[model samples]
Target chain A: MIHVDGLTKYYHDLCAVDQISFAIQKGEILGLLGPNGAGKTTILRILAGFLQPTAGTIRVKDYSIDAHFLEIKKLLGYLPESAPLYHDMLVYDYLDYVANIREIDKRQKLPRIRRLADLCGINSVMHQPIGELSKGYKQRVGLAHAMMNDPEILVLDEPTSGLDPNQIVEIREIIKKIGQEKTVILSTHILSEAEATCDRIVIINRGKIVADDRTANLKQTLSDKSRIDLTLQNADFASLQQKLGTINGVDRLTPIEETDHHLRVSISCQGGVDPRAAIYRQIKSTDWILLEFHQETQTLENIFRELTKES
Target chain B: MRQVLPIFRKEFRAYFVTPIAYIVISIFLLVTGWFFFTTFFLFNQANLRNFFGLLPIIFSFVIPAITMRLIAEELNVGTYETLLTLPVTFLDVVLGKFLACWGFIAAMLIPTAAYAFTVAMLGQIDWGPVAGGYIGALLLGAAFSAVGLLASALTRNQIIAFIIGVAICFSLTLIDKMLFFLPRYLLGIFAYLGADFHFENIAKGVIDSRDVLYFVSVSFIGLYGAHLALQAKK
Candidate 1:
């Protein structure tokens, strides 16, 4: 539904977004994962029409960001980072204003606001001033503002930041529900949140795309290498390495931690190898007491860190 | 154009959501009221000429104070992003805000009509200039509001916006009065540039198209400047 090509943005002489490009399909929950100052917010801002790109074009269907921004804006609902809404207006009044601006039918305005308030779970704070609401409530209100128009595309920047675990879960659920039919593009540094909600994840670092794939595929690629942790009691590192190091696929074994009578060592193997069975048999023949034996599970969090980590 | 109404309503009502609206209106009334009555009894005049004569200078300060927050506050609070991401265009935002400031200025002028009523009750006051003065006041308010909005758009700091707005509006109001400082050759041009000069011409009850065109042109120029400043922000 959306195509971004060579999108570049510069603030004076400093480059905020380099030559970056990506395409998002309709009904796909796309998550942009990056650390601070990684141009994630800048990218989202340019997509939302809040900032003009220094170069390149973004096309939504037949409308282009340059020539038909208003039409593109009509199809987009954007919530800026931290939800900087007008604080003085009451939540109800603010939503009403947004409804009016969205040009909803006069008869359907109140019902629409009510439905959004319920979806965002901000019904209780409707009469209170937005400035007085808690951070989580304010975030819910921001979500409502973004979805007020029920636009085809929703762009949210760090939608779940600064919320409690339950609130984060609620927001994730809301995003998931919205993602069932609408296209969503949310940016965040939180790996688990992205893993939980995004169907396709794009990892960006230093204003560049480092990785882009489905959630499971990102973890599947980590299978080429694996590590096993073994805690051996009464066995010294010299003998453990001398025996485990000679295993067919074992690359290296390093002592992780040592106690008076116990030793913990991690062994790394390469090329989709499993040296655990051989190592276990070798330990069985010895008089060493085995305390624990398990292989480390690879998660998307590890891939995210490795992809976006500073050089 | 239809989208301007929502923004206009929100901006107009936001002034009352805080105490600033009441405070600005009260201060405007006190200052103008004080100056008008003090001379009202001294000259024993039944006409509202003195009240209308003092409006442009009084408005030069009060209008800025009212409009200083229009764009500056939104930029400071970062709500400008949310406002722009909507379907509205830059002209819609600028026009909505400009109209809001002008509308507030109209509300401020509403209370001063009592001054005309009292003057009429006291003596034989000519309604011709009185009506002309009000029409001119609305035009002047619109022009000044546009200037204040441009000033507000030029900066993110409300205080700086207020100061810049005051500086420009004050110059426009008093420019004709300072013609003695300029060279003799530039006197005509400077006088014609003075907002007060054009304003007084309409206040004389003539409703001259030249004077009306002057206020309308000022409004257009100021709003256009604000539009350019906003577009440059991105």
Candidate 2:
């Protein structure tokens, strides 16, 4: 569990993390969605006890980050955005060193290291030096280091960044599996990744939390305005637009593309309106052939862009 | 205390994993060996007297080159954040790194014992003075490493760290000799504070507690400064 209240970090005059407050329950995967410089990394650093907050408080499992840092640190695993690693050391040696520093028992450290290496899929490269690994492998090794301690709280800053599509999916699956057991706060600009992995989403814009809710609920709130795309053959574009504008529940109608015999249109409709039926009847009466018509569902990307836009 | 050991082990092991530890020791031994051979055989000296005299001057540059990357490279490579995020306290990290550098310096001094053996074989050796010289060299190395660690903490550029470290060590070594222009009272205090004054006394095979205290105090001060800089980074 993590609680951040009125948390603010200032670098001279610029506020890195403005007065922001959020609480994450046990075993919850909270995605911190934000653009670059949205203070997401700063929030993660403060929670990990690496950066001291200039104002307010952070409580991890009832222990304040400032007052009980050692206890909180022992319970938390932080993977920074850069994945700071000692390049010259071999993968296994580096994790072994981390295990030792985290104070895991000598006898237990090797097995735990092996388990984490396998979990992050870096077992094959265990004997290779970290500097020689590719970016994807390096990222996995960083994740492996974080998981080595088996901390209850995991703070990952851009866990899927710089990975190829396949690696991203693999990391997403690993994060999903890990989230089932630990409290995870992952910050990422990739909206779809967050949508796929997180139970809840927290949208941060310009150092503030703008939206915090269940991912499904956030999508549902934006789903009221339905979108329909219509491609027509042999329809008069001007007259069709005017006639569709007259429909009661229709909010807006805009022609996307047009040719000699075909037209593509996007229609916005209010909640509970089945504009497809009306459009079908109108097109049939006009003697136009309906090539294709489909409703577009609201995606997390669309919602993310809409919410983070300048307001 | 428990956390310090792991950091120490990791840092000490890093020296061997990379070429840094070997390169530093090799260069130092080569240069010091050259000096010993040139002084004893070419100049016809019978003892390692010249070798001990030249060590502080050599360490003034070598120690910084060895220690410049201790913290600076970590910060540059972004590993500082990883270490800081661990449960270890600032003091533990600082002491562990300082000790690692100290350990490397000690290892470097190990091969120089051959020079001591060579001197004993060629002449009537006074073991007490030879022992005193090694003790003095260790203290000097420890002090230089501490100052270098502090300088390393001030920047992410290891080259800049090296330059600053060398500047600090050079100035400390030169300050006492340059104090003749100052008034009597100030010159007296400056001479006592300067490293050369204490190091010279120790090089004469004297185990004066005052000189020992000075090196220990400077080392403590340098390490403390390094700790503060690291804390500010957080």
Candidate 3:
């Protein structure tokens, strides 16, 4: 539904969003995962048509963003980071104002507002002043405001940053539900939020995309080497290393600790290899009783830190 | 044009949503009323010349306070991003806010009609100048509101917008008054630039094309500057 090609945005001398390109499929929930100053918000802002790119092209549907931004904007529901709202207006009034601005049909306005209020879980505070509401409620109101016109594409910049854990869960559930029908793109520094809510994750660092894939695929593909933890009885470090080094898939072995009668070792295995059986046979012949053997699978959090951390 | 209406409605309604519209209008009426009544008692005259004369000076301060928050508050609160991303041109946003601020100022001037009625009841008052004076007040308010909006667009802080707006309007209000201090050749140019000069001419019921054109030019330049400021984000 959205195609961004070699997009670059510079704020004076500093490039906020460097040359980056990505495509978002319809009805897919995509997460822009990055830390502060990683240009995740910049990319979202460019997609929302709030800022023009210094270079390159963005097309939503068939229309180019530079020439047909208004049309693209009509199809997008953008909730900026922190969701700046009119403090003087009530939640209901604020939504009404947004609906009017979005140019919703007069007859459909009330239903649309009510539906959004419900979906955003802000129905209870509809009459309260937005400024007086809690941070969570205010964010919900912002969500409703964005979805006022029932836009086809939803672009949210750090939607759950300030919310409490429960509010975050609630918002995640709401976004998950919304993603069933709309093409959703949200940016977050929270890895767990992205893992739980997004179908695909794009890791951006220093204004460039570092990795882009499905959450599980990214974790699997980035973790080419696997490590097996082993604890053995009556085993010496040198003998155990010599034995494991001869195995076909074992790349390297390091002794973790040594007790009087037992040794614990971490074995690094080459990618796409399982040497557990060979090590089991070797250990069976040595009379060194195998106490524990487990392979560690990489988590998304580890993959994220590895990709985005100082390199 | 259609997009301007929603923004205009929201902005115009926003004035009353806060205490700003009521407070500004009340203060304006009280100060202008005090000036008019005091001069009426002192001069024992039925004319509203003193009232009209005090307005351009009053607007130099009042209009800024009224318009300072129009674009400045949006920028401060980060609503400018939301407003700009909507399916409306920057011109629509500028025009909508300008009209709302101008409309508020116009509404504030509505009660002053009583002063005109009272002057006629007390003695013969020239309706021509009275009508021209109201027209002049509207034109001056519109022009000052545009200038204030330009200042508002230039800063996110309301106080800074007000200060910049007042500085510009204050200069225009009194620039002609400083002509005596200038060299002989510069007087005409300064007088032509002075808001008071055109305001005075229209207040006298002459309705000169030059004065009308002056207000239009000032208003256009101010609004155009504001439009450019809005588009600078692009």
State the C-alpha lDDT per candidate.
0.92, 0.89, 0.90
Please list the residue runs of candidate 2 whose C-alpha ends up more than 4 Å from where it truly belongs after superposition: A231-238, A255-264, A287-292, B41-45
Q: What is the DockQ of each candidate?
A: 0.82, 0.87, 0.64
Report the lDDT tens digits of candidate 3 across residue range A166-276.
Answer: 999999999999999999999999998998999999999999999999887876774776789999888899998888899988999988999998889999888677888
lDDT of 3 by residue, B1-234 (tens): 678888888899999989998899899999999988986978877788889999999999999999999999999999888777667788889999999998998899999999999889998888898899999999999999999999999999999999999999999999999999999998899999999999999998889999999998999999999998878876
Worst 10 residues of 1 chain B by lDDT: B44-53
| Candidate 3 global CA lDDT score | 0.90
TM, every model: 0.95, 0.95, 0.92
Using lDDT as the yardstick, the better of models 2 and 3 is: 3
Candidates 1 and 3: which is better by TM-score?
Answer: 1
Tell me the tens digit of each residue's lDDT in model 2 across B1-234.
788898888888888878988898999989989877875777666666678878877899999998899899999999999888988898998899889989988898898888878877887777777788888888988899999999999999999999999999888888887997899879878988888788878877889999999999989999999999998888
What lDDT is reached at residue B46 by model 2? 60
Worst 10 residues of 3 chain A by lDDT: A216-225
Better of 2 and 3 by DockQ: 2
Give the alpha carbon lDDT tens digit for every residue of B106-198 in model 1. Answer: 898899989988888899999999899999999999999999999999999999999999999999999999999999999999998899999
